[model samples]
Target: MLGAVERPQAWPSFLHQVGVIELGKDRIEGSRLLVVASQANRGATFIAQSVTKQGLMRSYVQNGNPPWLFEFFVNESSNL
Candidate 1:
């Protein structure tokens, strides 16, 4: 079975705080987001999605607070 690989240096620091969620490399469409392909801790694959830096910033402003995307992604991944 494949395990979560070390995050790329380019990945944002915020990703380190999300515990153990694995993401795919490709973004959906031109949207600034990636698919949360699998959840390591849960040992389950998922179709949920998370946003990229630009998307996160958008969410941060929309949410009006910290934890920019923790809440949004913790539940289920969705298209941008």
Candidate 2:
């Protein structure tokens, strides 16, 4: 959802806003996915809903599968 131009910088800020849970090499991939998801979720209400419904599709395409991206829905609703 974030414009392509915004994605690079926006990803980190989005991760911080969503409270990244873990750190290290294992978590790096997940964090990246979460950042992508967060950016998609922030673009607009519809985009947020879409991203949530799709369950990290953008993240998957962008960064491959990350375990935490799957767990994110358990800890936080996409509505936020």
Candidate 3:
């Protein structure tokens, strides 16, 4: 389960519509948001589609090796 602060207002509705029932959560400000993708393009595409579809902020792929092999951060904004 996610902490209440970690659950964004848009998450329940948007994630369910896309079949994302649950995910690990972290603090919204200055914290990393990670998503796993096998290919870089797919990762980019997923981020683009989700941001567009869900009225979320636009984020960029982080440079350098992240904690996870397929990790990227979602820049925090009002949408989150």
Candidate 4:
């Protein structure tokens, strides 16, 4: 989760509602940062988890030196 001080000052409320917030200036080898969060429902959880998986897949496709490996599981109803 991004700290309050790190969050954008003029962020959109709708983005927050959908669970996407804090597009940071930081980067990994020039790739911009994208932070997602959800404080409420299962829809938010799905967005967060889906974005995470897509990001990982993108990284693996772009860079495969050591072969990126990771595992995650999310059950939206329980927000696990």
* Candidate 4 residue-wise lDDT, 1-80, digit = tens: 34432454544444553244323433335654445545445454644565587654454346642322222223343454
lDDT of 2 by residue, 1-79 (tens): 2332235356665665344232343465644433344444544444357568977548657876467645565445555
TM-score of each: 0.16, 0.20, 0.24, 0.22
Q: What is the per-residue lDDT of model 3 for residues 1-80, given as tens digits with 9 covering 90 to 100?
A: 23322464645545553333232222344555454443534546655676689855534344443444245433322223
Ranking by lDDT: 2, 3, 4, 1
Worst 10 residues of 1 by lDDT: 41-50
Q: State each model's CA lDDT, in order.
A: 0.39, 0.49, 0.44, 0.43
User: Which is better, 1 or 2, measured by TM-score?
Assistant: 2
Candidate 3: global Cα-lDDT?
0.44
Lowest lDDT sum, 10 consecutive residues, model 3, at: 18-27
Model 4, TM vs. native: 0.22
Once superposed on the true structure, which residue ranges of model 2 sit more than 4 Å away at CA?
A: 1-59, 62-64, 78-80
**Model 1 root-mean-square deviation:** 14.0
Per-prediction CA RMSD (Å): 14.0, 13.6, 13.0, 12.2
After the best TM-score superposition of candidate 1, give how far the Cα of residue 38 lies from its true spot, in angstroms.
3.9
Runs in model 1 with CA error above 4 Å? 1-37, 41-48, 53-56, 61-80
